[model samples]
Target: MSKSELDEIINRSLELRKKYHELELTHHGSHWSVEEDALAFLTDAGLVGRNIMSQQERWPKAHSASELEHKIGESIWWLIVLADRSGMDVKAALENFLSKTEKLLDQ
Candidate 1:
């Protein structure tokens, strides 16, 4: 995808996240630290993982391919949110990671 596409996705995710936090505070009586958000992200990841395993086994309630794709996107949203909160430019960080891994593989 293009940078614009990535930017759109990240921007939307941040917007929705802000709304979600407000809902949590107003309706759920929630006051979550960054650490708590991280843990919840992990839980979402686990759900995605379980769906993958279940699909591999052809079991009931397994995520359809589209659902699985959406779940992966959701996990990425969490990563972006966490990275941005930590004052990192996640797109640049991803590019840096790719550069390092590519060089290591070429060595």
Candidate 2:
């Protein structure tokens, strides 16, 4: 995809998440506590990993496939927002991480 398309996707993702937060407030009547949200996302990541593993099995059904995809997408959104909040460039962070991993493997 073009850079502009990627940017649009990111922007839309952020907007959708903001709406989700609003809905949560409307129903749950409270903002997600930071610690709770972190723990919940971590738990979700673990579940996604399990879903991926199941899909790798010799015989697997597409159970909750869309939900799994949505969760993974949402997890990415969470990471992007977290990085932004922390004043870090997500692209730069990924590049630095990959560079370090490559150097380490070459050692």
Candidate 3:
């Protein structure tokens, strides 16, 4: 898909997330500055990776595949939120990441 196409989707997803979690965010004082939000995002990212290991180890008592999926989405949302908080363009960042990875792989 085109960069703008992905951007449109990210925009809508962010809007919907804010609408759905507005009250929860306000209750938890989640309007953190860029650095704080980025750190929080990193924590969520860690959960995503931890959940992957849990799944591999068949440790579903606490972490299931569903939890893994949820954490993955949450991690992605964290990236979007952190980028937005920093006034960075999520689409551009994604494109740059893909380019860098492709180059590294000699694609």
Candidate that scores best on TM-score:
1
- Computed on alpha carbons, the lDDT of every model, listed in order, comes to 0.87, 0.74, 0.76
Instruction: Give per-model TM-scores.
Output: 0.87, 0.70, 0.71
Please provide, for model 1 over 1-107, each residue's C-alpha lDDT reduced to its tens digit, 9 standing for 90 to 100. Answer: 98899999999988988988998899879956789779988998997887898779856774588888888888999999898888999999999999999999999
Whichever of 1 and 3 has more TM-score, that candidate is 1
85 Cα displacement, candidate 3 (Å): 1.7
* Predicted candidate 3 versus true structure: per-residue lDDT over 8-102, tens digit per residue: 76887679657746765777756545676578778888888888888778445466778889888877877887777678888788889999999
Task: List clash counts for every candidate, in order.
Answer: 0, 0, 0
Worst 10 residues of 2 by lDDT: 54-63
Residue 100 alpha-carbon offset, candidate 2, angstroms: 1.9
| Tens digits of lDDT, candidate 2, 9-100 | 76776687678779889999986666656777787787778677666762365657787798798788777666655678776887799999
Clashing pairs for predicted structure model 1, backbone only: none
TM-score-sorted candidate list, best first: 1, 3, 2
Prediction 2 global C-alpha lDDT: 0.74
